[model samples]
Target: MAGVRKGGDLEEVEIDLGDASDPEDLDEGEQPETLWKASSDREGESIHSSSLVDISDTKPLINVRDPRGMNDCLKVTFEDVIAEPVSVRSGDRVWIWSHALFEVSRIWVYRIVTVLLAIPMSILSGILFAVLSCIHIWMISPCIKCILIGTRWLQKLWDVVLEVIVRPLLTSAGRCCGGFNIHLAEE
Candidate 1:
């Protein structure tokens, strides 16, 4: 799925090329060979104006010979940022990326949200932990265990909020990323 921001909406466009092994399949032996079509043409119309030489056989798409529109962009990939999380056991690597997610962030807004949310959540969670600990020591094992279980739900809610709220704002206002933010210069 590719994320595209068109007309003020950040959309996830799925280009499911089940097997793009051959471009020939796309051309009914007669794919439109125009550089661009008439702007006035109705949607889905094959006819277009302006033509470019047939270099389709050489490459599936054209290189960015022009960067008239692209400015201030970042890219992210799965293997680089989240994969190979630090090991839990010393000298033992655990490839536990079962829930790995990447996100693009604007420096200012993301930092502000982090500061606002982190301090309160951390303090509240710490207090909850301490209270739960005391409860457990007082033989209230089930109640303490319940709060421990609730933590996982809170984690999931945080994940959803980040995706639904944070990602959209950042992509539209901060970066040109759909889900993940721009990649750093150094891994």
Candidate 2:
């Protein structure tokens, strides 16, 4: 879709093409000529104009005289322009620039609205996220670290208790139960 905006106020227009005959059945080297019609609303009334032209022909549609092998369909020669602004009023008839036409006012409106809302909303969300992150780092992080340090100290105390008290008791019990047989005899 294409749009032409002149000032702060945006005016939208649309073009709708009716079902036309397909040119696929034509034989090789044959091009199909189509009756093209274009219409617009003027003062709440329909105004239409039509022309007979070959729709399937791929030859340059804009320039018919140039033989320089430039097949560009939209080659503009500045010489063709009048260089003066032609006065056109609302409801006045205007010629269609090309055979093809399109419009996208609704999509354009949605896009602009999304962009407008996104800027402020993103800033607010970013500020909220930063505040939460600071709280987690400054307040919650030190508390978690202290808990981790306490757990490590407890683990070291448990190891020391096991080594000093439990290991000797287990060894003496094993000796009394004949678990180890070591004897010295002077024979």
Which residue runs of candidate 1 sit more than 4 Å off their true CA positions? 1-104, 141-187
TM-score between candidate 2 and the true structure: 0.27
For model 2, residues 57-96, the per-residue Cα lDDT tens digits are 4435555656775766654343243233556433223223
> Please, what is the TM-score per model?
0.21, 0.27
Which residue pairs collide, candidate 2? none
Tens-place lDDT digits, model 1, residues 56-172: 443443565245645434443445555444554333223333323233334556788989999999999999999988877776777777787979889899999999999988779
Alpha-carbon local distance difference test for all models: 0.54, 0.58
Winning model by TM-score: 2
Q: List the residue pairs that clash in candidate 1.
A: 37-48, 103-180, 103-181, 104-180, 104-181
**32: Cα error in model 2, Å:** 55
**Whole-model lDDT, candidate 2?**
0.58
